[model samples]
Target: MRLSTVILPIHRWAEGQKIWRRAEDLGFHAAYTYDHLSWRSFRDGPWFGAMPTLTAAASVTQRMRLGTLVTSPNFRHPVTLAKELISLDDISGGRITLGIGAGGTGFDATALGQEPWTPRERADRFAEFVPLLDRLLTEGSVSYEGDHYSAHEARNIPGCVQRPRLPFAVAATGPRGLKLVARHGQAWVTTGDPTLYENGTPEQSVEALRGQAGKLADACAALGRDVSGIEKVLLTGFTPDRGRPLTSLDAFVDFAGRHQELGFTELVIHWPIPDSDFAADEKVFERIALEAPAQLR
Candidate 1:
């Protein structure tokens, strides 16, 4: 029943830093920002680089873990990302979690002037990317030649502060993606189906999430992996049109309780903005901070 939030880097560095510090003071277990060249509706709006923003956040926050909501193979080569991540882990004193995904068809997908890929092609690239990234982070002088990515004697000097490597919180919904979670992830994250949230009742959304978890459990079973070790994180503030948004303490509590029933170990809500998709009263956060910990714990 842990709680966390995502703070979009749409503000100046000073304001963003203040939010990061405030999030920690508010008792959030983790804080994140999206990793993208530019996001969907916010593409034309102000945004900052995920790594640099997180680096600055790490310097200011003491206990809360920090990371991108999800990084992907859309633009970054794993070797380069691995190097940057190891350095980030050092900066955060082992408090960095890499939330990664197979990528989606968005502004980031074509922002780098790359060819569009089908879902199958994206999955294939992700399959190669995660393993290579895993090897580079945990082993030394790794070399790989995959269909989409290659590393030539990539050296991981000084490795990561967190034992084998920094924790990987992999996002997945489909079977193949779930397989990656079973194989490499320390945590599994889901937002359920956005369309389901849009058209279905709250109960239906919970059912859909449960079904997704069941698939992930099956994926782990196939690999003889223990599902209990993997943390389950549900991103509650997924779509604006979802039934009864988490706008206040009561809404968040109800939403979190439902997901916890579905076996989610962590629940993430997005910070409110003045005028945006996740718009809400910011005071709700203060209420949650003052009241949630005792009840949730």
Candidate 2:
């Protein structure tokens, strides 16, 4: 399995650049960041824009792929996001992946002075968002209208460097969302089940993930797509076990082994932040980064 890290955009470039370069130097397959105006705990802190942070990351790192853990329709319009993604792909030399999702109700939900969408509404907007954005990246110019979005010859000239556009690591767990994944995703992302986050056991969390992966396979089958073609990514820390997996190389190997058995092709862990929700011993985290994957293999 490939290992990756999610570096929150909480540092200034002077220091952030080193983190991005270190992620590559440490051998992460990819380094992603949360795409938000301001995330939960870091809401009041110095959070940066995902695109600009990624652009800077691309300049500093040469090998590790870069992307947002997710970008959403919450405050983004497909037309404009498509343009920025194209630019990011070119700047990264085709090393960009777009992790998108049906955004949840959070600070980002109303950061734009709008009410948070009902789950149904968010799903509806996401259904509309993905395909339109897909066409925007593939075609030279797009002119279309949808229930939630529109494009008027929105030109994406000289499009993506990753011909046919960069890979999409779409995040989904529900049926409708899984359908979108089967149709457009190069990778499937999950944070396990939020309901289990606070009260569930590790075993329960694994079962929940198993069920979700089964649904994704069913979605792929219905569409006559090979499920194996899509990578399954588990973004760690939200699961019940939380930071326990990063406590040691052996702990990570065991944790990764269980999930790998369930067909997870990639595992993403947070970059340790001292005294924060993501807090962990940086040395142990680094050891997992450097040794766990090889041990798992």
Candidate 3:
């Protein structure tokens, strides 16, 4: 399985660039940053725009693919986001991936004073968002109208550096969202069951994560899509308490092994920070970087 790391945009731009370059130097296959106006729990903390951060990251890293953890329709219009994505892909030399999800009901949802949506509404909005994005990226010009979004004469100039458009790593947990992944995504990303994580049962959470992987396979089958072509990514570094858990190198090896057994092709975890959400020492990552790959394989 490929290993990836997420560097939160809470740091300064220079520091962020250093992390991106270091991720590539450390043999990480990909690197990402969370895409949100402000994330939950850290809503009041330093948060930067994903586009600028990723664009700057692309300029620093050469080999490691870069992308947002997930972008949503909450604060983005597909037309504009499509343009920005193509530009990012061009700047990255076609090494950009798009991780997308239905907007959550936290800071991003209400940050602009928009009305809060129920779960069903969020799903519906996502349903409309993905296809429109796909069309906007692939087709030269798009004019479409839907319940949640509309694009009029939107033009994608020069298109994407990646032939059809940059690969989409869509996040999905429910059936409908999975169908969207089957239809449009080259990769699938899951955070597993938050409830299990909050309960502080890593074993149970791992089992639940495996079940979710199975569910994604079933979703692909139902849609007559080949499961092998769709990459699977799992997020494992999140903590139950708002603080990061000190993960041993051996523990990470087991975590990677379990997810690989579930057919996940990639594993993503947050970079260690001091006294923060993913709080841990940099040494933990150093150990994993040196030992986990050989052990897991």
Candidate 4:
């Protein structure tokens, strides 16, 4: 399985860069940041917006990839967003991977001057965005027509240099979302313990996650894609307790391992990554960075 780490930037803005450099030095596969316009507390620090920080990160890291944990479709137009992903890909020698979701929470969208989209609208917008992104990043020109966006006169000018065209993935939850992954994306990007049952039981947790992923398999079969070839990628973040006084780290690992056995390709770890600085709450960040990797193993 491929292993990667998240640069859970806490305390100061400088730490984000420091973490990226360290991730690159440690030979991690990817370095990702969350898409957060603000947070609950500790509002002060040297923070970097996901896309902007990546431009700088691209210049700094040689092998490690860079991207957002999940950027919202409302944040940018499809073609424009494609440009950003491709640009970063070129900067990183095709090491960039995109993680996006059917954006929830209108907070950032409102903050960015982009109107928030409803769930159905978000999905529809994604449907528009995906095809447009594919065309922009792959072909030289695109003529797309959709509810939220349409493009008739467009050229894939300065397109991404990657072979597969900006190796994109979508952050997915629930059955419909998972199936979407199989249908259009390179992989299914997820966060949290899919195992489900927290205060409940293992059977409950397993069943919930299984039911969700099962839908993806069904979706793949319907689309005539090889269901067995579908790659599973869960981005684990929940801090379930361990076994003993040390909290054996059982929650995240076993939760992941169950799905890993189910055939996950990669499980990128970005734990307790506050949308903003947690200088007073850096332990969550530190404990996760230092101990989470061990748990993943």
Of candidates 3 and 2, the better by TM-score: 2
Instruction: Name the candidate that leads on TM-score.
Output: 2
lDDT of each: 0.87, 0.95, 0.85, 0.64
Measured against the true structure, the TM-scores of the candidates, in listed sequence, are 0.97, 0.99, 0.95, 0.80
What are the per-residue Cα lDDT tens digits for candidate 1 across 1-297? 888888888989868888999999898999999999888788888999999999999999999999988999999899999999999999999999999999999988898788778999999999999999999999978988888899899998989999899999999999889999999999999988788655666777777888999999999999999999899988766633352545667776767676788889997878877777777777877687667756765
Model 4 bad stretches (over 4 Å): 8-13, 39-47, 112-115, 174-176, 192-203, 239-255, 271-297
Candidate rank order under TM-score: 2, 1, 3, 4
Q: What's the lDDT of the predicted structure labeled candidate 3? A: 0.85
Output the number of the lDDT-best candidate: 2
Error of 1 at 295 (Å): 1.5
For candidate 4, lDDT tens digit of each residue in 1-297? 555666543434465567678667655567787666653352354445677777777887888778777776766677777777877787788788777777776456577766666677777777667767777788777887777887776676677777757766777766556656776788677553534425645555455556657777787887888766756666654322211111234444555567677677676664334442212234433443455556656
**Ranking according to lDDT, highest score first:** 2, 1, 3, 4
Candidate 3 lDDT, tens digit per residue, 164-265?
Answer: 999999999999999999999999998888776666676777677777777888988998999899999876665342223336776677667766887888
Candidate scoring better on lDDT of 1 and 3: 1
What global local distance difference test value does model 4 have? 0.64
